[model samples]
Target: MQEQKGKYEDLKHDELGIKVRSDDNPYLSADLQQKILQPRRLSSYFIVLIESGSITYHLDSQDFTLTDGHLLFAMPNQIFTPPAKTGDLKYFKLLFDENTLALLPQQFPFLVNPSNAQTLVLDNPAKERVIKVFEILNQLLISDKYETDTEIILAYLNSLLSEFNSAYFKNKGPVNILNTNLSKFTEFKLVVETSLTEQPSINAIAEKLALSTNSLYRIVKEYAGTSPKDYFINRLMAEAQRRLRYSNTSVKELAYELGFNDPDYFSRLFKKSTGKSASDFLPRQDLSGK
Candidate 1:
């Protein structure tokens, strides 16, 4: 049984903390895992590339069955536990910081705001190539090849992601209602992401985009199957979860930051959207600068 001295903590700097430990290591608490008690929270951003075999993962009330050539991503503070006794699952898990994506080519706009939800699943051929890149990254991680090493790894990862995104997310397949509406829908998505901070209205966004609100609504309904207000609320929900999970800010402070005038209204809206009280998400301990 492995015994750790202190609680798991995020890295001190804005750098990824790298540590290689076996599943049996007490820090990972293999015994607790066997007993179905997993209190450990991930302290860094990482990707686990499944080389062979399969594993079941439970995340946010969903069960994901990951097989060979599949990739799993873990974001900071997310709780995880090993699957019940899978035979020697071997994979290359790369742990890095936000800087890793920042170092990627800026032309890939999707990488600009990398979200934890953006998990990439690669097929065999694609997975092999990414693993080779990781081989180079593994060398860089171990050897004192400090200069240009990060750049090299970043480029390799970008290449892998580019191909994976094209295959899995990008439209190259079936042509139908979705294909016809992809461009406009994508533009709307971009507008939502860019303007959520400003809290613009549907009519305002439609005006800015040079389209009438009714026309935009029709297109959004065709593709997204929701009204503009509902869509905006969905976007706001995502931002709220991100803040609640990552930041140590209070509910009132977060409400103000999100441009909500009434904290109580914000709390009610948040609970309606997430089915959990804002206080349940906010850390109990007071945060600095609050």
Candidate 2:
């Protein structure tokens, strides 16, 4: 059977859309219970707000525990799994495309600000505001009062996100260590993101930082908990994945564009790093070797 694509369903009631579901939207989740939700690919971002109970999230070989009032943001196109089942869990999840978020930044600049690392906790006041926003959206969705007109919805979304952004900033306490380390990490990610096509080396990054390679690696490891090479490779693989999934560039072309002299070697490296071949990662081509 062909599955539903880009449809949001209220898990508790199939006929009823989640209180505030958008038309053919990209953002939302079906409640999972008892059993573990295995690792799988998703095409949209997930903003998970845990209302009650607890859930464990496993991503990028890291484990995070989310309990009541906690929130998490998961980027699109990544593999995620809900680790070992505990008890009943209730969550309000929003799944939106990246473009939807992009559209938000201009109106609510804080949404796009990288420095806002805090997440919203479900306090009475905060919860009330969020629920109110959802309620308004529900009315809009059901009434079709703003049919095909996203301006009102978008305005409400921005207001909700602004509140969320504020809460996030407040909950995160002053961290001297993170403040310094984050600066380095951001610079490193920026350099790698901007220079990946050139395939900049560790030495090159160190030079840009005006530090010796050894010193730079030590600092990065202290903050990022990963070696420079590993970090850069992760960045590179991310780019490769994006291109593979979203573009028509052949493997050879991708390799060349990524500054690999030998496309075959790039292919092998990519497979080794991700445990999936280039063709397999693309949504269009189903290698499905999970």
Computed on alpha carbons, the lDDT of every model, listed in order, comes to 0.60, 0.60
C-alpha positional error of residue 220 in candidate 2 after TM-score superposition, expressed in Å: 8.8
Give the poorly placed runs of model 2, Cα more than 4 Å off: 1-38, 82-88, 105-122, 138-148, 171-231, 234-290
lDDT of 1 by residue, 84-147 (tens): 5478775666565444444455333232222224355676777778777766656555555344
User: In candidate 2, residue 12 scores what lDDT?
Assistant: 20
True-structure Cα RMSD, model 2: 10.3
Minimal lDDT window, size 10, model 2: 9-18
State candidate 1's TM-score. Answer: 0.57
Return model 1's CA RMSD, one decimal.
10.1
